[model samples]
Target: MKLPLQALDPDLFARAQALLDDEWLAHDADLAPVLPTVLARGVGQDWHKAGTFRHHLIGVARSLALWQQPRAVRLLGLLHSVYGNAFVDLVKFDMATERGRLQALVGQGEEELVYLFCTASRREFTQKVLAGQIEPDGSLPLHTNQGEPITLAPDVVAAFLVVSMADTIEQWFSWQDDIYSRFPDTDTSRQQKVHWMASLWPGPMRPSGRMLHQINRLGLALQHPKLKGRLPMPPVFEACTAPFSASDDAAAASLYWSVIQQDQPLADLDVATGVLEQAVRLNPWVGEPQMVLAQLYLSAGRREDAARAAESALQAFCSWGNAWDKRVQWDAWIAWTRILLQGATTDGPGAWPERLDKLNNVALRAGA
Candidate 1:
């Protein structure tokens, strides 16, 4: 599940809606009209008007409850998928999926933002989990070959677990209901088959299972506000063995921090190549590792390595998208730009002047 509140099991939507109504939403006419557009495909073949705003509402509302002020969550949840969906094709991914392409066209920072709320919502979802709130899971696999547990706050985890359940209820099960109910007692009826085919092979969703999930969550939260936040916390496993070593807050932090703070901390994208090498060894896919390594190389006056690292960091950030911590991705691009500028100032290497021009141009565009 992508968000914790999505799994509230009962009345999730009603409670979330009620809380929102009483708190921030407060019957804002300006926002209500836009709800249908966010779910414009207009439902599935079931004639259920499936993908109405209410479905996504439950998932987003529950997830945001952890950290988002009611108003902000209302806005973020409502707008999260406003641009692109089965029904709404407001944004396009025609843009390249790599940093070089985006940076060339839009410059660094703007490119990062473009990818953030656009297609990178996955990243934004995870950021909540990292901040100790319950949030959703993502395809961004922890390359910790050992699958180590990353500690997060309980309430945040609850929110994420719920969101994940809602995703299953609204996005998955509701999308293909018959397949789940197929008793498959030998041959199936053509009508049933066509009914299933028409259900999804054509377009968007049906709101069957989603409503139940919302109702279930709301009921649970209202009844047991205290127990509503309970979720089993799994321990970080040794990546190589999947063996658990029960970790408290301090131990996990110490181990993670040791590698990060080693050979000199990678403070705001200013680390040496040696430092980056260690970081990449420990956490290779991390965006900052590559960015800082690039910065470190540029500082030591190594042009080729610096360029390569810049490319890696940019590509990493872009592919991951902004859905999960869009701000951090922007910071990566800015940091790269700063390094490029520094190189040009020092007469560093090939096409330094061209790089400088592009850097300034992107900065101007991004208001950097």
Candidate 2:
């Protein structure tokens, strides 16, 4: 069982409370009626070996409030995990039988947001929104478990991003606590969360510049020395300036690669590789698919294939106008891969470490 908030270290509790207060939530009266019930149900529940589930929910809500999101959005953050969303499933509340009560407490609009969030299919959302599949007017059509398509308005998408950021930030903070020691699989989860945020940053539904700055600050905070090795770093590359126009083959390749990253069965590795080959064939000019293929090859210990894919990435990066500004990032990747290949091939003086240090210095200087 977790200690009560009051029992936490005074300074730590104070710092956490200060962070929460920064979100400027609505007056307590608005949340008063529902607070007790939420706390009661979440009391003994653990949130991924972090603090209590109630605490995580509160942190998310506070984060949304900090982002100055609308009341409905804040409430949605508070209730996001109650019905088992894509990333987490701490279902202390049943949505089906308790809709009216929840709606009555949070208002119809807020309740609807919670319902949509809880029922969204994570895979489809990633395929459509994160992969840049949008309607001409910039709306993303998300499918629920029932196979019904719901086109999200731009404002709703913005709210969703805010809530998602809050949830992810809270999780990252939890990873800093000793209770949630890093595990082998933790990096995959961290990567997916950061990738979602990075991909959405360049979308039409992006948050305000100020909000984006705040999100970046939170990301940087996770890089504190103590937490640096425990969590996956956010992508160093800037988001694509234009929306992706991936062919079906490319999209399928991305989907397969996503599955592989999530620790899917070994059988999926061959399928992912084949799909990536098809992607490269369908769109030889796109650097992203080729880069992903390189990573896949590297993971399989095929250094020669990895080197070939890295060369292709450089070629595609040079020819792809959308990647013009990302040359520094691509250069860093190429250099890193070369060092790996060199280390594998030579038993001479270990200059690779020095080269790697220089590479890191260059990356830091380049603000990557």
Candidate 3:
């Protein structure tokens, strides 16, 4: 049968099939009967903004199998959304309604993993796991469907990591296929997923070092070949490198203070511009430094540089999504900068006052 993902990206579909065949899942006696049922459940359901739920299930299972995870872990990945987990709600099959049949098919161990993956509260899990809120004895506090606290066993935690990584990496590739069109809100959802994956490090319930390393490598390997240099480096892996050592806000602030405190003239602007450039390189998602650079270029009479910086700021803002206050601020800055560039090109600096007045009006209206 033609998989839904085959129409979206033939290369990826082939890769998934290759992995499944290599793992012998394509011919597994236990999985053969269950696979059709799982696919049928997801026949018309969408998964994220990419392919159907069946595609996601198969993709995640293929990823886990390729990673050489235990059979139970791979099975968990295949059925992770059976009970409607936080991020996905396609199947909505209740364990209480069909636990015996599932357990009989995949065994109790794999069935339990599926139930855990499906029922765990994502918000609570992220808060507890990412925030270093585990108990002193090293158990991570996770909640069951009843909202009661339960400690995850070390092996279970490890399995969870494998499933989570497989699920996230699959989704990441799907998003990358047509990022803007798939996600109209921009890359905000993608960014959140990357951040969550990145934050898994230096924690009690963190995945093993080997698993983390594999995840980093897998993330790098999944990038769209054409978007290699156009998009920022995958945030999960980039966080491990040197140049991204300092946060963008911190780096930008340090540069701003150094230049402003010295009251440097426009001739010395190169020094400040170098720092701003580095800041953007470190974290292109943040727009503050780009906007600041645009203002500096405008003051220095570099119309082209100012316009480019402003455009970069606009792109960054759009990528960050539309939080109301930030959207207003970015819209004002973008409008003002574009108007300044247009006026400079048509009438030279002689029209500065009139352009400034127009910008002021825009700011006032945005603020209001």
Candidate 4:
């Protein structure tokens, strides 16, 4: 029995296989000819989540697909993630520790080109870290000790931006759909997602705007021939995005600042609270409004209010993560939170805060 050729990447191969289920791997068929080019045309036909530090390689391929890459510079669009995962360590700023099989598939020029992509991707993460917008703790952290901030040429920035946008559009579904499938109808899972969102971020300045843009962009892309298979989403997504119009986001954003921002005061606490309530109703699933309101209470030095808000944030945290390069930052944040909590509560078995010896003695006596 002859097996059909397939792209090396497990995911691509699996998807290709599913697309041609009528044929078997043991018997080569029409899909045979399609597989080789699929593996050859792009970054190669494979990817590894752990090996590939970030989505930069995918971004690079996206750039190539959009004709952003010059002829000499482009080799395989599919080989995007091969470098970081197998050739280099984008996060560690080092060559990959393991060079098992992929080393032979891609040579020096191809590898060097991939390195350029990695460097460019690192620059993006670097800017975010320097701005204190993203925390560095993932496989995709700051790349090098470049004495100081590295300035990129304008063209590179444009290239990076295009790749970044395309990468995110692909990831929103690629990454999250996996989560949805795993925990389809779990309340606890949904609440955890909501909690995560609340704890992190300053809160949504424009939920409706974000959703509207995402939905519209996705719809537009689906109409294109290249993105045909990847375009459509579950019908429920429409219901999810029903209220994310520009007008709705603008109104919610206006209502939010009315209550939260010190620079702008439009009403009393009650009125501000009312605006938030309306905003929340406008987009209940989003975590930002709840967070902002909670933060507002805390800013006024309201301890209970702060706790309540923090609790809400925790409950709403999304476990699946997103493509805006947000997960690494949050993973860092959660680690800090764990350390702070342990230190604060470790006063020798006290009720939050008490004499260490006394608290220990009380516990000892209770046991007796």
Q: What is the TM-score of each predicted model, taking all chains together? A: 0.28, 0.43, 0.44, 0.31
Clashes of each: 50, 2, 0, 30
lDDT of 1 by residue, 263-300 (tens): 35546444344544654443333245566556556656
Window of ten residues with lowest summed lDDT in model 3: 1-10
Give the clash total for candidate 3: 0
List the RMSD of every prediction in angstroms: 24.0, 18.2, 16.8, 19.9
Model 2: per-residue Cα lDDT over 1-368, one tens digit each: 21011111234223333443423333455555667777777544664423467656776765454344566776887788777765665776788798888888889888888888888764465445443454555455888867888877655555555465566544432122112222212244345354554433222221121222223333343333333333223221122111223244235434434543553456546767766666566444335556666666666766666656655564443322112112223234434434443433334442223342553432211211
Checking candidate 2 for backbone clashes, the offending pairs are: 23-65, 23-66
Top-down lDDT ranking? 3, 2, 1, 4
Global lDDT of model 4? 0.36
| lDDT for each residue of candidate 4 in 1-368, tens digit (9 for 90 to 100) | 21111112334223322323323321333223323433353423234231132233433333233332343233333344344432234232234553323333455555454445554444344244223332222122333333334444333332333333334333332233232222113233556465565433333322223332343332332223332332222121232233245566446655654554543445545566556667655543333455555544433445454344433332222211122223333223323222222323234442222334542333211221
Model 1 poorest ten-residue lDDT run: 1-10
lDDT for model 1, please: 0.37
